[model samples]
Target: MDEHISEAIGRPDLIRLDDGLLCLRFETMKVVSALAAVSHLLDTGVVRRGDTLVDSSSGIYAYALALACHRYGMRCHIVGSTTVDHTLRTQLDILGAHLEQMPPSSSLKLDQNRRVDRVREILRENPDYHWMRQYHDDVHYLGYEAVAERIHARTGGGSLTLVGGVGSGASTGALTHYLGKRSVDVRLVGVQPYGSVTFGSGHVADPEIIIAGIGSSIPFGNVRHDLYDVLHWLAFDAALAGSVDLLRRHAVFAGLSTGAAYLAARWERREEPGRTVLFVAADTGHRYVDTVFARHQEAARVQDLAPRPVRGTHELTLPWSRMSWDGSPAPEGALLRSAAAGAGPGDGRRASKCQRSRAAGEGATSM
Candidate 1:
């Protein structure tokens, strides 16, 4: 008995895909974070029931925030990336959230920059509006604590390997953080798109589209680089193979990010036979039906595909690459500069070491 549709949608189903592999599937994952964030704002008097909240989103977060607003009796304004499709637009419209989509751009970097710029302009015009800052604020991590509890309870609190896209870091990072608090030896393997700066793969461009929700063109303040144990950078074709294989083999039709995570999880599970491996499927396959499933013929066999092991970001190559990121800090050239400089809208402060640690500490308290 969920109180709202958001609660129902946010709850994930843990499905066993193999002997040691599990899939945590969600209809739309960001709803977990969005609902908790808005409720916290209202609870703390930072925002009221009717105050408008704004942020830049590509797709999932836009719908999540809109639903959150609808549930909590608030208003949502989304500055959306060019990837926000007609389906999502229609949903936002019906949900009463305002959406301002960026003009079409082939470059994901440009699209992301435009969305952030638009958000800044909106904030200037409406100073009273609160920016959710999903990529930076640790408040988004609060909701995942309950999710972690579920995982721990189901899995019985042992050494487990968690694989998922290193998106804004709320999902995987928060899960690992809370699980570790309960003495679970959680090995976090982060999946990334080639052009994502989150883990310094921006130098190597993906010829195809950067997988929207899994990675980011700009630096995300919430991504805890040190939280990841290993990193895999998968290009569009590799992820397509993964998505196709996931559906064909396990009957789990999920988004591109899930495909990437599935591919990574399969490898990690094969490599470490002793540990239980679970990956996050952030959304369903409906959005990717045309872009991915339609071109299933071209996808490489998941059994035949593997990531090229790289010693460092400098060694990262084309279709797929993997590197050991065992508790490492952000790379030297990534958006650490922009984050420190507060280069864009909503990135109010430098994510200095002390500040990031303090944010993580505060998040732990919520758990």
Candidate 2:
């Protein structure tokens, strides 16, 4: 039996959607990463039970971190993104995680930058607080080791193609990293929103919102660009079509990111007829009911939709675009931009004399 609700919620269900296509669905995906990261930090003496763990999150990671803190008797203080809705705010409040959400902004970059700046400010004020840099730190990848083991056991070490959002790089990157060690021939396909800087799509802006929890406007240090074999950029309308068709055809009610992955996975399956293709459904469709599912009537036919094949990010176009990355390293252009912006690993750290001065203090009791 699971000792905590975090474990239960972190466990994912592998559902076969077709002869060669599968869906790895999670109710709340990041819980696995958050739990393992917090436990590792505590065990390694980097933090204790009571230290207030602070981080910036859009929505899912806030809830995941809150649950992790609840499991480990830590206090969580989140600098939330503008996308954080009332439902998540209520959950965070009940979970005992203090949230200070940013005012809604017109630009994604501005919103993300504001949150990062806020986290730095919080760290300076509360020097004892540890910033869980989910975008930049690799500790978040540890939890997926066991998850990869489960996937290997079920899939029987065959040639597999894994498709999912490259958000924070922990989910698809960590899973493929561990599975590769077990001799699984896995091809990683990452799905991105049009405006995400992670995969050179920052130059193109989608009129609609960038799908939350999957893509980012700022550079994420942990995104191992070499781990990805192909890339797909989907606009909101394209993702909506995929999501609507997924519910209509397969009865799987998943979020917009899942819909985008579903579309990419189907294409990969067609390209590699013998390989088993599995896509990650990071969360359920409930949060997207109004923004996505409610507008199902306008959703295009998934059968009629196809990605515009591109040679490079420069060639990326419109509603949907696909490029064969071939396991290449991070683009030189992206690296230069990151260096100029100074947004890589160790960016979130704020040194202070009071660091670890109260390691023995008792932490907040778990909810």
Instruction: Give a tens-digit lDDT track for model 1, residues 1-367.
Output: 9889999999999999889899999998999999998999899999998999988888888899999999999999988877788888999999999998778886777777767777777777898998888877778888898999999999999789999998778899888888877789899999999887778888888888788777877666767666788999999999999999999999999999999999999999998999999999999999899999999999999889888999998999989899988777777544433343222112212222312321211111000
lDDT of 2 by residue, 1-367 (tens): 9999999999999999999999999998999999999999999999998999988888888999999999999999998877788889998999999999899997877877777778777877898999887766678888998999999999999999999998877799888888888889999999999887778898898998888878777666566776788999999999999999989999999999999999999999999999999999999999899999999999999888899999999998889999998766666434323232222122221111111111112110110
TM-score of each prediction: 0.92, 0.91
Candidate 2 ranges beyond 4 A from true positions: 336-367
On a 0 to 1 TM-score scale, where does candidate 2 land against the true structure?
A: 0.91
Give me the candidate number with maximum TM-score. Answer: 1
Q: For model 1, what is the alpha-carbon lDDT of residue 225?
A: 69
- List pairs with backbone clashes in candidate 2: 50-363
